[model samples]
Target chain A: MKQEHIQQIGAAVAAVAEKNRINHFYFVACGGSQAFMMPAQYLFDREIETPASIYSSNEFVHRVPKALGQDSVVITCSHSGNTPETVKATEFAREKGATTIALSNVEDSPLWKAAEYPIHYDWGKEADASDLNKGVLYYLIFSVLHAVSPREKYRKGMEAVAGLNDAIEKVKTQYAGIVKEWGKQYKREKLIYTMGSGANYGEAYSFAICLLMEMQWIHSNAIHSGEYFHGPFEVTDYDVPFIMIKGIGATRPLDERAYDFCRKYSEKLMVVDEMEFDMTGIDDQVREYFAPLLAGAVLRSLADEFAYQRGHDLSVRRYMWRMEY
Target chain B: MKQEHIQQIGAAVAAVAEKNRINHFYFVACGGSQAFMMPAQYLFDREIETPASIYSSNEFVHRVPKALGQDSVVITCSHSGNTPETVKATEFAREKGATTIALSNVEDSPLWKAAEYPIHYDWGKEADASDLNKGVLYYLIFSVLHAVSPREKYRKGMEAVAGLNDAIEKVKTQYAGIVKEWGKQYKREKLIYTMGSGANYGEAYSFAICLLMEMQWIHSNAIHSGEYFHGPFEVTDYDVPFIMIKGIGATRPLDERAYDFCRKYSEKLMVVDEMEFDMTGIDDQVREYFAPLLAGAVLRSLADEFAYQRGHDLSVRRYMWRMEY
Candidate 1:
């Protein structure tokens, strides 16, 4: 089942990119889909001139643009493919003269039919969809665009993602231990602050949702590491748990400064990086591009097992999409 | 001093919009700027087929696309106009072949000269620049655009803002009491949640900053009220102080629902709105367009007094752009 869930990394991405050749390239996704697109959007912008706008489907459908051309590709991503906003956005995109693409885990889900081309990424209930490795799905969507655009740097991006499977294997056991430890200590946390920079900001939001929204049932804030100094630093008290996502990326310096600043006011700080951990399985110094996905993968284990160990079923929380009005 | 600060509403907006008749618009604002632009961007896009792209100014100068011959207009709005990003964004826009228009309170400041036209309507220090009544600044920026295009709807928008000012006055003092009550009760609270919809989401960030960074020196989280159901509800215990920015416009239904939801988890639920308070001295609400600005004004008073009563000094907690990095 695990092997079945773990996709052929390159082929999955290449397929998505291949299909993207004809569409207008606008995206409506929520949670992980939106999270993963942060890095991919920049990658597409840096390489090809494809301009993809990512919005929460809930917000998009209510305010659908009238100007989308018939040729526009309105791609929607939802792990469950059952999220109301994603389903509505896909439909709305279709209504507004655009072709819809649904990238989801479930086949024949509502979003699947909403899209002109449904790319079923049958991952099953294996791991957190918001995890950056799963973010590979979003990257794969862009990978489809890159294949047709034919750029060297874009191809290099594909090569970078190719190492994901091997990287996953190398870090699995080590992260399992970390997850076990975190699960043990999860309940004692009063407040959690998740910080990331550049591409990692999306992962920070994912962490906020997965742990705070999914696992520990806690309230957490995701602040860009650069903005930490702007105002968020004042709230850093010794008891607060500050989870800093430090990767060897463009945001390394900012993350370092934030970590250092936290040390002054916070004693309970968890740093997630190769340098901070005992890297028994994973290679030391993963490329910055892949670190976000790796960090997300590592965090999934921490949030899931931690919540489970505390006798909390993910669904027991009974998430309600009920409107207040 | 208070009287000198009250600039005529319509003229202020018209002057700034007139000053910034350029091609592309880059808005440099933090909290309030983000709120106003959330809907304003849609207005600009729908009206002229031009989409307004926002950057935190510092981020824009470094990462935005090349700007030569773009014939751009950079409008930087700050309650105080002392924000570092706004200052830097204005200078950066000027360097890259863009005309700068600064809408700020201070008459002679860095941002004033940074722009081709600086519409200075100095609201005294006591009137929080972050407030919507200070719409004098934001209005000027938006109105300038309205004048250039001469849209009947926008002109009607000005009429609507003028009409709302009286409604705003009827609720001012009541909210002051809400702030006082919240501040007193906040001593026992561990965390504060700032919730809003659409433009209110942007304002929520400022509210969090006010409490977390300025006021009680407590940890706070800003969330879209609509998004609370997907997660965050599990963490909504009695220890949380939920602050809701109640909108009276397009998102009124969502805002009202958000307020009701907070009542369940929040030990103290404070709703900042015109209906909830007696707005006697206030007179700036002319259109529904300025609803965010009005809501912000009430929040500013609450945030300011809350911080002062808690013995927190803004000078010490507030971020300085130069020292941030």
Candidate 2:
């Protein structure tokens, strides 16, 4: 991300903190943007005393929590800033006297107009990792965390964010060749399932929903690794395709167990283990929290390779932007 | 549910509320039990001010929230009352000084032994609707809600529970033949998807994970109806088999959009719409909250019918009890 963009995010968060006493946090978005917010929510759930919840944008509007008021901070994101539900959620949150922040790649978007604080992140080929949507969300979340309780993890986390762009790029470069081999090996498969737990579960979900089903039009679903043994594991067999994202930190055991089981029964199993990746740019103290975002970044290479090998353009869609629901 | 079970559940909740300040709530379980707690969590998220969150059993143990304390109330469930993670979680919650409640079909089980409040519900063929797992959960959740905020919804919900057994039975009988027809049509399908939104999403998740995948070893997934528009909707095609549970009240429009789209694209679509059902035993004011549990009860017949038509015994399992994870 450029220095100007980083400065702008800092200023926006600062302004919100000055004007509002944020006792609760509500993160709302749709599709990929929603998936992107999970790690931050997970962090907030563990790291803070105050409540934070993530919701599908429309669900936020439909089931407006009674706690949502002047003390609530509502953060919403949409790539185009025109996603109807998300824009409306921002508007609704503002009307409820909550602090509303909008993140979008588009300049002067509907979400930008609706929210009290609007921050733009960069996207597409020219965008750096810091320029991506996570930059805006991480800045806001970390700022809030620092304000609420200036703990070491939150402080170290903010310092480490500066290195993440390079760290993620390194991981992506390392995975590029491997993903191409994966692309060729698994090109013809029609259905795939992804699984992970804790922080990285969001990456697995995003990979399945946005990368596979939306971008590739391949039937896919994300199974939480901890929850997998409960029921979904019965589907395990030699022909089944599984992508396992083994997270770092406390939940690793859950992913490892699922991985061990999957490797035994499934012939077509792919893994992106955070333990195997070299995240040199990130600080060791805060690396666990960054694993999901890192895993997600590296997996984007896999999606791209799959798109290439399958001869499908990632941007091509049957409905999404092509039709009105 | 029997009168004894009803009385036992009420006393347990009252005891917990008396001993503890009841500041926060945590629901933990595995597989179907975990899915079962979702409706209660959804209701608590909407109905009360004291925050409540649900987690898969193991994740709850691993990521024990900072909020879990002397003032917290944790409710756990496992059909056998022996799910390792759930037992561990109950123990952990108690260790953290939270009042722990365990719901199970089995008496003298690990989870039952671990919790401060252990309530047994009837299961299998002899289990009445009130005697089933829902009896333990619904009563506990309703009683807690009444204690915290005795809103009409909570009081009316308790009164309505008495009639629910008969109402759910009626819905099941009405769908019995319809499910058999569905079983015949969908018998040969190797893969299927289930979708719902709002209150009934838990039913969709439970039906997909526990009913289809675990019991039948079929590859299945639950796609949130609201999320279908985001990415999963791309999977819509003539041959794709989808079972939709349409929720009532606020989020009905979300489910309807997916249903409308899927009906156009998919030939093999089965639906259980709460809007179509005669929920006579339930009060109109609180019917929306009960829709998920009711939908779950009725869909159990669909699962049974599928097992029959597929020539698979629902009791047969490749992993669950057959071998260790």
Candidate 3:
């Protein structure tokens, strides 16, 4: 979150990009952490004209792409700084002579020690971890990409990066009441369907899996809106619980179609549209690129409210820390 | 299933490989068909040393990769032969001067007419359309990859292609009884969890979304075994229903880890292990490559039995073909 941290990440990335002729970037992590990296991956692929891939740590270790080499960079994150799969994948990427960057909350953990460049941010459990992680990732990813291809768009985005904290705070404040109400209403739902498309799809996936399923022990499925009608639509009866995160982008129509269909069939439909939130400092032209980050802040409020209404602590787990896998 | 069909597909793929200097491949489709293309995409990335990407048709149309151009090839499939998304994607790919290949059930369908090369197959709805489509894909994909970089391993695999029908039949016969029992036992369960890793992951995804959810109107979630522990595992309890597909591959241990954990917590766990079914004619060394296709045949039997036990016809859909989206 510091200006110095962004400069450090930029310097590290620039050196690697110059030495290795890096053209491909991979963001590797497990579970919710992996989802946090997706918006940056989407930005790199769309805005920077570089190939950016987001991979689950376990899968990346098994099916390491042949395209990865000295000319590639692998960025990994773990809040505890010691997720096994992520540490293993970081090690594997280093073994393949690729540059490895680690983002962790602890400075002395295994993931931090494994990477050539470690971006350590010490944040408390009470803070929204996903929003903090994304804040760092936006700077880390765009810096490296901007260094590779200097453009007016990248420069404009870079100028706006300084105001992201303000923008995120604005989103949280504006959407707090609605988030609390929706979470309270849906707290007892046995099963829920969450839908999104494009960059916001990762946020939708994380909200269902990490927040609802893992934190609250509720059954949830995150369906890509584009693929929703293909099969998942069969479950859309009048009483089905549906939560949709609508973003403004090229994939907006895809989510809109699903939203329209759900309105007709399901009575219990909750939507969090990006257009509803005011990203105060961000320019309208560049708002679509930052939709996921804005949405992540707003969704975290819902997760907190859901935890409160459901009488479940988000940190409590049945098996994750209770026993060894 | 015929030797001549294999040869014809190989010849067509080889010609495209030669003409375009193709180094990138995109498998584009929607829903079950998108899942069908995954194994071929996996094989192309693993064996061919080329960049292979799989995209849902709508996503592909919106975010057509900057890397896609004259040096790229787009392969799509539609069982109904008139999926609007696939037809649009094929047209988009062709506009970008990329070679487009379409596999469809009907010769006169729009999808068939949109492709530069259309591989038409006439198959009844009673047959497992997924298996039939995959059989053609294995030949089409591997042949193009082999032409790009010839190897004895590929040639040996090519020779074994002719015997796939016999291998698939053996799988169906071997697993028939168990499949029927599982269908009968789990017919009343409202929600099911399905997990798979490596190449067979797509089959697990297709089984949950296409067969269980779409056809039977049952609720199911297909979690990647490597990712099962990340969040989905929290939903597991004594009464939870789980159907795990255990495949033999580098990612086998990941599935085994989940299977071991699930057995300890859940009372209801049904496993369809690739090791159980004897792929008679397929060589042991190459067995992992064919795990998905083999698993597909075995799972189709479960879908059939579930339909019978639940007294719901697979073809009866409330919305798919009944209304306009």
Best candidate, lDDT-wise?
2
Candidate 2 per-residue C-alpha lDDT over A1-325 given as tens digits, one digit per residue, 9 for 90 to 100: 5776667667667765685466678889988889989888888888876777888888878887777888888889999999999999999999999888888988789998998778888877667666778765776677778877777777777777777788887888888888888899999998899998887877888889998988897888899998999999998889889989998877899999999988988999989989987878677877888878888877888888988989998988887888778
Encode model 1's per-residue lDDT on A1-325: one tens digit a residue. 1333234334444444545334335667776566765665544433444344556566566445434556466767887778877898888877776766677777788887787766655463454332333544544643665566765555555445455655665666667776687667656665678988765777888788656654567778887776676567767777778788886665576678788888777777777874443333323332555567778777766777756776776555543544432
**Deviation of model 1 at A125, angstroms:** 8.1
Residue-level lDDT of model 3, residues A59-157, one tens digit each, is 888876777778788999999998999999999999988889999878779998898888866475554332366656766666676677776666656
- Reference-based lDDT, each prediction: 0.60, 0.84, 0.81
Q: How much is the lDDT of residue B26 in candidate 1?
A: 56
lDDT by residue (tens digit), candidate 1, B18-50: 554444555665544444455555445334533
Per-candidate Cα RMSD to the true structure, in Å, reads 5.5, 1.6, 2.2
- For every prediction, compared with the true complex, DockQ reads 0.29, 0.75, 0.67
- Per DockQ, what order, best first? 2, 3, 1
User: How much is B33 displaced in model 1, in angstroms?
Assistant: 5.9
Quick one: ranking by TM-score, best first?
Answer: 2, 3, 1
Q: Which candidate, 2 or 3, would have the higher TM-score against the true structure?
A: 2
